[model samples]
Target: MARIKETFDSRAWFMLECDDPDCERRFDDGQWYAYEDDLLADAKDDGWQILYRDEHPELERDMQYCPAHRLPECSTCTNIMADPAGWKDGQCPECIKEEIPNERS
Candidate 1:
């Protein structure tokens, strides 16, 4: 697949593909992922691996499972607020600390 590199509203974006060979979903917008914070970092921490293009570091993007592949629930809280790519050991950091934000804004 071609590397994705684009900007919208002054924000830079890279392309993301699903790891599942059967579900090679691609996403250019970060919002669709619905990460708790720091999309890349959070995704990585949650066990999602990123694919890097050394030749195009600016376009280095991570591989993530689409919502259809994500598990719903905070492993620790047993709450349906966990993001498969943003949780660790089946638990979310926010839920572990009991500090999940109330709103996105």
Candidate 2:
């Protein structure tokens, strides 16, 4: 196939692009999948980076990423870092010392 329904978790469906220059596959598994937070967590676990892209405003899917890349943004505070070292364990330094926000938020 052309398309198949897949999920990072069994719940929500998250689309991820293959960052490999030769690959660059855009995943469009459809929205029937649920539990996006789980997918986000799974992406972090897999060392994927979430990058902001408006290339497809017509599709309304601005946030996209490559599984091979990792942006140093705090998943909790949503603050992006100039230095990738600023993030630790999927969080900013301050967030590492603080509690994780609601997963569903």
Q: Pick the candidate with the highest TM-score.
A: 2
Best by lDDT: 2
Listed per candidate, the RMSD to the true structure in angstroms reads 12.0, 11.1
1-105, model 1: which lDDT tens digit per residue?
A: 233456666665555556555876554444443332455665556555444445325443433455556535554555544235566655666664676543322
TM-score of 2: 0.32
Candidate 2 local lDDT, residue 50 = 53
Give candidate 2 regions above 4 Å deviation.
Answer: 1-12, 18-32, 52-62, 71-105
Displacement of the residue 82 alpha carbon in candidate 2, Å: 9.0
For each candidate, how many residue pairs have backbone atoms clashing (under 3 Å)? 1, 3
RMSD of 2: 11.1
How far off is residue 35 in model 1, in Å? 12
Error of 1 at 62 (Å): 8.1
Q: On a 0 to 100 scale, what is the lDDT of residue 42 in model 2?
A: 62
Pairs of colliding residues, candidate 1: 50-62
